[model samples]
Structures are given as structure tokens and as C-alpha cells.
Target: MKQFKVIGVAALALLLSATMAFAIGAGVGRDGTIVGTKGKAKTVQELIDMYDSTGCIDCHEDAHDDWAASPHARSIYGTGRAAATMITAMKNGFMSWEYSGVKSTKDIKVEHWMGCMKCHLPQLADATDEVAVELADTLNEWYANAKKALKNPDDKKAIAIRDKHQKTLTSLNINCLVCHNRMAITHKWTDGYPQHDTVYGFNDGEHEDETFTKMKRSLIMDESIFCGQCHGMGPNLELENPTQCATAYGSYMWAYRAEGGQESCQECHMEKSGLGHKILSYSDETMQKMAIDFKVESYVSQWLDGSTLKPKAVVKVKMVNRSGHSIPDG
Candidate 1:
């Protein structure tokens, strides 16, 4: 009887230990993440402030500068084109669709904008529906003012309005927190959720930052899958209305990895290319040179046709994509 009781206690202890382990690894029960702690941002500026990484510049000046030069900095307002496209998608796509639930900019919700913002500004997920509507209206105003400014060229009011909205749109981007914290862990249940006060990187230790005082190691920080989360495969079916963007990661997996190519996105775009935080594509001259190899051969030959000899010019061109994925990928 005593032996049976001992066995029962031992089994109970083991079960409790397993349960505790699972709880710790379950990632704060969903509402304990940084975004959750902060709650949903109500405005565009509030959302920008929620994921602000301006303080990072004090310690990581070089990385900040490099990142500022990258498209990630102005992700939503990419050379003024991205903002226009966002508005176009809202106006043409959401408004035109019968069941999108968005008939106008005011009707826009967080889910409606997720198709674009999912990559451009993942932080948008932490914002309220009102923020989404505000962002849409702001982009529309920016587009209209920009057009007026282009026509007049000297209308300071139009130019000022355009610039003001541009600044707001550009403020919300894939900043340090978005990468090193929010998106640092893909398998949250396995690796544990990214803590609000922890900055994930190559090592786990004490950090000097005020807000993010602890540094934790991210398993996928240097992996291609880290970038793949946003770069994507094909159409994003998760949303009610799917939106297809860049398939570079898809091509990289099937075309490159399937064929035994072993390079990661960071290996080519960051390390070997020496672009570092300024992760560029074909836009930068260095990336352009690294992505492709071209060769041309031309010769003049004499041909005999019946009794007459004719001169013929022949040109041979060869090109190869040396990058990991397709040449013209988004």
C-alpha cells in the first residue's frame, strides 16, 4: 500500500513538471507581448510612437544610418510611390470589391490594410481600426496634395500639406523593434514569445537600453526564414481578400534551395554584399552588379550563297542570375 502511494506521488510530480514547462514555453498566453502590453494604438502617431526606435540611434548610430538609407526606413512611403500604391489599393481594390467591407477610406479597417501593411509596416497589427482609417485618409490627402503641388510647383500650401502627410506615413516603418523584437521569433510557442523588455540578437545578456534592458538570442535572426516572413511566398491567403506581392522567397526555396543552393537572404543581401542594415535589392548599384552577369560576343562572317559572298553580322549574348532568387523580384 505504501509503495503504491509513492508511485502515485512520483507520477503526479512528473506531470506537474511537464505542465510547468509547457506553460513557460507557451509565450505569455497571447496578451503578454509588447504590442499587447501597450494595447491597440488609436492613431497614426500613436502607432508610430508605440514601436518607436529613435532611442536606438543613441547606441546604434551606424546601424541606424544604414537602415535609414534602406527601403525599410520609408517602407510605406517608398520614394513617394509606395504611398500612392497604398491609396490605389484602398480606392480600387477595397472600394471596388463587393464583399471587402470597405466602401471608402473611412470604412478601412486594420484587416483591410493588412495586405500591404503586413510587410511594409507589420506594427500596424498592433493598431486599432481607427488608425487604419486615419492612415488611409492621410494617404489620400497626401496623394491629392502631391498632384496639386506637381501642377503648380510653387504652391507652398499644397507642398506643405503633401510633405506633412509624407512625414507621418514615413514615420511608421519596419524599425528596430519590428525586427529585433516583434518579429524576432517565428515559432513563438517553441522558442517563447519575444518579451517587451528584451531585445533579441546573437546573444543573451544584459543590454544597456532603458526600455529593452535584456538581450536574448533569436534562433532565426540570421536565417532566411526571418526575411521570408514578410518577403513572402505567393498570395497571402490568411486575409479575407488575398494580396500577392513578392515571390522572391518562393523562388529561393524551390528554384534555388531545391537545386542545392545554400546561401541565405542575409548572406547575399547583408554579409557578402556588405550592405549590413541597408538591405537593398536591385536599386543599389552594388546589388545590381552582384545580382547578374552579362556577356556579349559579336563577329562579322563571310557567307557563300551560290557564287556571291555576303557579309553577315552575328551577335551572341549570355546572361546569368548570380543571386539566390530571381533577378527582378520585389
Candidate 2:
């Protein structure tokens, strides 16, 4: 009996075709081993590398690049660390919240409010720079974080962190910029001898590199107002701390190189228009004996009650933001 002849020829042909298709699907092709037919494989890790702690290199590639290792940057962050510790003492309670991830304005807006930008970001009295607006947005974002903390300050976990941060704030680590932006011109802002007429400029700029250092800050090194941008408060205050630097200057232990090796805030926080971030530094012991120093002193008199003539007293003070930032004053 011929078994192959039992089924119809057409049916046999269909069965053979179906068998061939199943065999093709089940087995591997010439590519060796068969994997999922996704796309080509990636070479780099999706997320692995971390940012380097080498100062503001990417943003400040020029003169400030030189300054990245200087004490100015150190003081800038140091002041912040000291401030955080002070806030911890205040016992706002929410302690564990970490702000170390904040690396830029975007980070500040999205993460936490730092004491430096709260004031040092700069607000021009007679000018409005879009850069300032970017800075303002960043600070406002910080305000948003603070407001969030304040609203629910009663939360046990949040309260602990808040109180801890509050302790740092109360320690007077942040100083003027922690509260103010405006400074009085007081008098002639002259450096050396050749007096030039005063010209107002914005506190902010977007120059990726080599900006005001070549033009402005190089010239205005003597004016207290420049230093005031971070330490003075009145109309320019962005945030208020009861422990104001204006009230007690020695708390940060500032040392000055500007006025004969004296310690003051301006000596280190000095910004040349083109120079990038200035990181100031300090210590508590050195700051204790340091007193408020002024470059110029003035007095006011109105003929001792007679309306004949008048004069007002003014003074200039120079300080190193902290120890070892020995860059001198005019």
C-alpha cells in the first residue's frame, strides 16, 4: 500500500508549505544567535558621570577660571556652609533635606534657596539687566522653596529641617546679600588720583567670559557701594534675617586685605565686571577681633544751629571676606 498516495496531492502540498513556515519561525537565522529585533545597541551609559567640583569652570572660562581656585569662591561657598549650620541651630526642624544637588540657577529654581544668591545675585538701582531677571527668577524659585517650608512649618520632619536651616540663618553667616541689594553712593567714588565722573551700570551681565573685568570692575575697586551690593540693606533687601550682618559684622570672622591687612566683607567679595564668581572665605576666631573698617570718613555740621553752612560725615570700610583672601583694596 502506497501511503503517500492516500491524501490528495493539493492537500499534501498545503501541509508541506505550513510545515516549512513553522520551521522557519522556530529556528535561528544566520546572524548566529537571535535576540529581540529592537534598535542598535547604545555605547554610553544612560546616566553615570557626575559633575566635577572644580569651581565655575564651564560658565567662567577666562579670568574667573583663574579665580576658581582662589579664596573668593571658597568664601562664597564657605559663607553658605556657615549659614546652613546657623539655620540648623534655629531648630526649624526639617533637617535632612539636602541642597547639595543645586548646581545652577536652574537648580536653585527647582531645588533649594541658597543664602548667596538671595542677595549677591545683584539688583541694579538704575538698570534692569535680563541677566538680573534670570537671577531674580532663580532667587524667586528659592523664595518658592522657603514659602513652601514656611506654610507647613509645623510638619515634624519639615519643621526639623526648617529649624535646622533657621539656626544657620540666625548665625549671620550670609550677611548683607542675605538681606539687601542697595547701597548709598554717599560721595565721590574715586580710586587713586584721576577722578572720573560716576557712571551707573547694571549689577548683572551675561558675558560668557572677559566682560567687565576689562572694562568696569577693574576701575571701581574703591567704592563701598560695590561691596554694599552684598552687605548693605535698605531698599535692596531681598531677604530679611534678624541676625543681620549690618547689625553684627564680626560673626562671619571676616579678615580684610583691602585696608592694611584688615578684615572686612568687601576685600574678597569684590567683583570685577568681567571676572566670574568670586568665592570669599572666613573663620570665626579671626572675625572676632576684626572691626568695621572704612576707607573714607566724613562728618556733618550745620554751623552748630546757625543756618550758614552744612557738612555731613561719611566713612569707608574695607574688609577681607575671611582669612587668606589677601587681594588688597584701592
Candidate 3:
């Protein structure tokens, strides 16, 4: 009993010490974490805790595990380089963004979570449930309330809650719900994303959605409009061919836009023939070696040869998986 009591006391002391150490936004991580605001948000560990606390773990426990092992999670968390730089900027007065001269590698200290859609969670717009309507109405109400507060800055009662709501930002991120959920393809005539699933298999026509009265969607896989939302190479998710690039989905089609193969962004980017959500970071080495064993396409006989005569035609069939993903290279 004496030893047990002593152990309990020791544990209690340690717990209290940790609790006391926490400041605003401070939390733990698999490695070092920064805490506090973007300026005061010190350590990389605290940022990781913020990311983990976004409630993504509840749905994507497995993908999160894989993410922890990926180079992305490591680079973001392990390298305190960005965190240190953010601190420097904070001291200089640029509070949130840790500006870096380096283009690709530069990331905000906690700049990601400023929005809800960045995380791979499903967009509420895609919801078929009344929950989206409820949430939207709530946000609208809150927005109105906050707007009123802005008018009367002196009102303390309305300021606090409205301030939190007004400043409520999420880390730009994604979870497996994004990758696993259905996605639409791009089109020249419409916006991308929230597009209809065309080339992507599963629901060839419709998309998988929950029952809802009114909900906004992120990757709505219903029509060409949705895929164009992101696969867009043009302004405002409007579909257009980027001059230097091939197809928006990384296809060899810029040169052949007139061809029927002038496919949309989701045609190549979204899952089809073993494509994953990570998008194409495939090296020639990965895209070079065939991963899949067999071809997964069907050819229409009517389109194959003239129907009039059974003329034996020499057909050159080459099925190459050029995209950096797992495809059955037959």
C-alpha cells in the first residue's frame, strides 16, 4: 500500500506538470511538437498534435498509420526546420505564415489547417444527408452573428464566441476519406471536382453519397463539373488545356486535344486501373516497371473494325501503364 501510494503520487505529479506545461494549441506528438499560436506555436510536435486532433483518426485509422510512415508525414513533422523559421518570422511580426525563399519546400508553420477541406475527409457538400443543411445553416447563423459583432466591437458578450467562430481555421489536410471516396473527372465545358465519375470505375454514373437534404461536396463524383474543380489547369476550376503540360491527368493529350482522348483530369488522376489518391509522383522507374498483371479494359467490336466484311486487319495493341501507380502491365 505504501509503495502503491508513492507511485500514484509520483504519477500525479508528472501528469500535473505536463498539464501545466501546455499553452494555447500546445500538444504532444510522435516526435517534437510546437505549441501555442502560429507565432507561439512552438515545436513540430504540437503541430502534429493539432493535425491528429482534427478528428481524422476516427475514420482513417489505417491510412493515418501509413501516412506516419510516408516521407510526407516525416518531412512535415521530423524536420523542425520549418518550425524554427516560423518562430523567426513570428518574432519579426509576420504572425502566421513562415515565409521561405525556397519555393517547393517552404510550408507555413501551421498554415495547412486553415481550412476544413484540405484534410482528406469527405466534403460536407457531398453529403446527401440533412446534416449538411443543418451545419450550413448553423454556419450561416454564426456568420451573421459574427458579422453583427464586427459592427459592435465593444460588445463583449457577442465578441468572444463570435471571435472564435470567425477565426475558426482548420489545417489544410486530407484523410483516406478523400482518396477512398468517389471522384469525378475534368471537362472542357465545366468546372472540375464535384464532377461526375466517368472514366473512374465503381459507380459508373452516380457517386457514393450519404442521404442528406442539402450538403456541399468536395470531390463530388457525379458529373464532369466536379473533376474539373481540381484537375483544372485553368482559372477558377474552369477546364482548359495547360500549354506546357499534357492532359491535366498527366496524359499525353495536349498534342491531341481534338481526339476523343482529350480526357478530363479525373480520367487519369482519380482511381482507375490501380491509381491511388497520392497523385502522380511516379518516377520513370516506377512507371517503367509494370505493376499490374493484366489489362482491365474492354474494346467495342463495332469500333474495332468495319462491320461490313470480316476483314482480317493487323492491329497493333500496346497496353502500357505509363502513370506512376500500380497497374496490371500486361
Best by lDDT: 1
**Each prediction's Cα RMSD?**
8.1, 23.1, 23.0
Question: How many steric overlaps are in each model, in order?
Answer: 0, 65, 55
Off by over 4 Å in 3: 1-54, 65-257, 262-270, 273-275, 284-330
- TM-score of candidate 1 versus the correct structure, residues matched by position: 0.88
Q: What would the per-residue lDDT of candidate 3 be over residues 1-330, giving only the tens digit for each residue?
A: 999999999999999767655532232321121112122213223322333433445544664665544323422112334323223333333223344221222322222211222222223222222332233333344455656677988877676765443332122123322332233222312533222222232333443333111223333453334533333322222112112211232222332243454444345443342333333333323323432233454433433354564434344455654433223210
- lDDT of model number 3: 0.34
Backbone clash total, candidate 3: 55
Q: Return the candidate ranking by TM-score, descending.
A: 1, 3, 2
Q: What 10-residue stretch in candidate 1 is worst by lDDT?
A: 23-32
Q: Weakest 10 consecutive residues, lDDT, candidate 2?
A: 43-52
Between candidates 2 and 3, the one scoring higher on TM-score is 3
lDDT of 1 by residue, 92-211 (tens): 888889988776778888998888989998889888899999998899899999999999999999999999998998898999999999999999878888888989999989999888
lDDT of 3 at 54: 35
Superposition error at 280 for model 2 (Å): 5.7
Residue 134 miss distance in model 2 (angstroms): 16
Q: Local distance difference test, per candidate?
A: 0.89, 0.33, 0.34
